[model samples]
Target: MRTYSLDDVYATCKRRDSWWTVYFVDPVACRAALLVGNRTNITPNAITVFSLVLGMASAGCLAAGQLAAGAVLFYLSFMVDCVDGKIARLKGTGTPFGLWLDFMGDRIRELCCATGLAYGQYAATGNVDFIVLGVAVVVLDLFRYVNAPQMKRVRDAIREANAARTPPPPGPHEPLPHQSFSHSPVPHQLGALTVRSHPVAAQPSRPPRSRKSRRRLLRRFNKALARRRVRTHLISGIEFHAAVFVIAPLLGQAALIPVTSVISVLFVANEIFLIYRMWLFTRSYSAVPKPEKSREHAPIGGSPNV
Candidate 1:
């Protein structure tokens, strides 16, 4: 069997990925894991289980107020988390159980990390506020995790209903004489098509306009900013854990705890808003009357044959 390259593994296993995963973490860690995995009989589920163990160890370290050690273990667990999906894709060994285990592991890790970090902070600072914040973090995170799937199902249902209600495009048998065939080859009556070659035109170049160029740059920047905001709000599991455990601990900044807590609150609010919108959309969709099946099959009232 041929070994999968880092690029191949990444291409096959990448999810709705975050910038940290794409640009920083997975590039190095996942590559190394894939390289090791190719030489070993390690399965993706095995990796996922190992990651969960590591995450638990990380939480233990955090609870013991071993910040640096906890940070290192947390990152190590995340790296393993990245590798499991890649290994699954590479070996074609992904199962529903594996996926469920993976998701469960992520949620457990988040909860453990949140609780551990809060306890560690309280132990270090002797502040009850840390404990409260920690509990809030876990609750918000859990709500986001649990509600997200339900919201997705609602949105999907709405999308499916809308798609069903909309009429499909006319088939070849239907009249569509006005439709353009400029790009496609002309079809023959004998079920074949032939391309008619046309001469290409060279267009004249225009000088760049400073105002228009500035406007274009502004638009691009705004679009990129908007995308970044969305990705930040839709924070991935590893990203959130890494920020609180790894980055904050390394920086010796306990301020990140409150900051991340605030972010979690905002994220919860965003989820609530999304759920409301989805509910509204579903209600509106449900109120619309569907066409009767018999009427669909009936002839037009003004047909000459009728």
Candidate 2:
């Protein structure tokens, strides 16, 4: 009897990266990691540091012209990455720092492996092209670094604006406080009793809604009942995929790098925008009135008033 939420949907999408058509996913690998997580000793960040060590050692070997060793090392780093996240999920001990480390380590490992490739090519051929490729990867990564924070700020602003527009919820978020929203009689002595409920829509439908239609609808349903926890997976995926396909093959693809880089950057930008969208949803939901409260209050004259 497993209860699922919006996070389940997003987690499913994210977990696709390491899933198997034939066998179970890397999350299966995380089972071992979870047993390790339960011990009073093993920490997620510790696992993160170990993954970095594997990545760095592999990059060192590759840069020194050890091709197979570098590839093995690179492979090991991703394996460790899976374990860390798996451990977090399995143990339910998610930490901000551990999550941040996992993300940073992934990004750094990609850069390091790209650098190792350039180094290997240059050292073997005595050509500057490979080295130049490494430098370009670093530069593009810096662009992403700069974009991330700026986009976060924009998202925060949108969340705040949406929050201001959506009135605060009428009841307790956790335990019900001593003071609560209540309804009093409408002051008419001989009138019929009436109740009011304004319908709140569900998640988006397949036919596709107009922008104005969807925006208003989402703002109504996205609150404490759901958190945008899965959004990190989304932005992370966009950034990771963009780096892999669009940014990684820049060595011989001279004319294509700029175009790919632009598309990747915009993809990241769009991911940021998606984050804002999720935040807006959460802000609206956080402020939505309770169902009973909606049921208790009726328009005095039947003319829809706030």
Candidate 3:
């Protein structure tokens, strides 16, 4: 029999993840999934599809005014969503199609849940305003969805450029020691034991910025906002939907749904602004020649040995 440590569970997660994902959600769900996965042949794509079904069922429950059941299903879907990615990373089975499918599922779930909650509220209170709010939520969410890829492209381009400029580390190094696995004969305690592992976050290597370059106030501001740990937790779609559709409804405060739409708009606007800044940054660097190493005191138009 195989035994897994908490470190094994954490190794599957992103170093820099959303605060709620890191702190509240993924750790528990992924750990549970890891244990189940050790004993089962369940695939990550299957879990993704299962999560989507749960999300749809949650939306149906919300539309039928089963608030408690809807909230429970919605949260369960989110937990499963967390599990799928971890499972994929652990099993080395993550694919581009799987990622695309997961994203598409999230968008569908968001739209359905928003509409369901709005319709449910309208049915309960006869308020037409809820319909407008629901439409706003969907539109803003779509805007975000469209812009996300563009933002990712810009970020990827920047990373590529930085990687091209950075010199590779000297190699011909000693081989890394082989890792060994162990199995325990006795069962160990399960659940509620938190173990933390520190993984270094990857940052692009770039030349030091000059004072003039640093004075690009807007870029500096956007960079600061981008680096904030709490930003994703507060404004990301998953967290927003969880708060609005699941937590708020569970607490019997469906009025908070409109506020979530407003927050979505704000988040979308912020993303658009950041994308614009990244485009400008990318454009500025495109004109610059790539840096090359030069020999000290090398004569012009002659070999270094001259």
The numbered model that scores best in lDDT is 1
Tens-digit per-residue lDDT, 1-306, candidate 2: 233333342353342341121023243444445445545455668888889989888778767766666656665666676666655665466699888888888777777876776777687777776676667656656766776687678667666666677755655455343332235333323457443333377977655468868867766544321342223233344344334332343333342235445545665676567667766755665443423435347676673355
> RMSD to native for every prediction?
10.5, 13.4, 19.0
Q: What is the C-alpha lDDT of each candidate?
A: 0.74, 0.57, 0.73
What lDDT is reached at residue 145 by model 1? 76
Q: In candidate 1, what are the lDDT values of residues 1-306, reduced to their tens digit?
A: 677677776676454466666666777666766786679888888999999999999999988888888889988888888888878877788999999999999888878987898888898889888888788778767776777798888788778878788877889787564554446554434346444444478988775798779979978876675554324334554456566778777766466566676556555566667777777877777654655456555678854335
TM-scores, all candidates, are 0.69, 0.49, 0.65
Which runs in model 2 stand beyond 4 Å of their true positions? Answer: 1-28, 34-41, 92-100, 166-306
Tell me the RMSD of model 2 versus the true structure: 13.4
lDDT of 3 by residue, 1-306 (tens): 455566776777776565566667776786777776687777888889999999999999888888889889988888898888887877777899999889888888888988897888789888887788778778767876777787888778777887687766555663322221223234243574333333488997775677558768757665665564334324666556666777677877455555565666666766666777778877776543655547767888888665
The number of clashing residue pairs in each candidate reads: 0, 3, 0
Model 3 pairs in collision: none
lDDT (Cα, 0-100) at 15 in candidate 3: 60
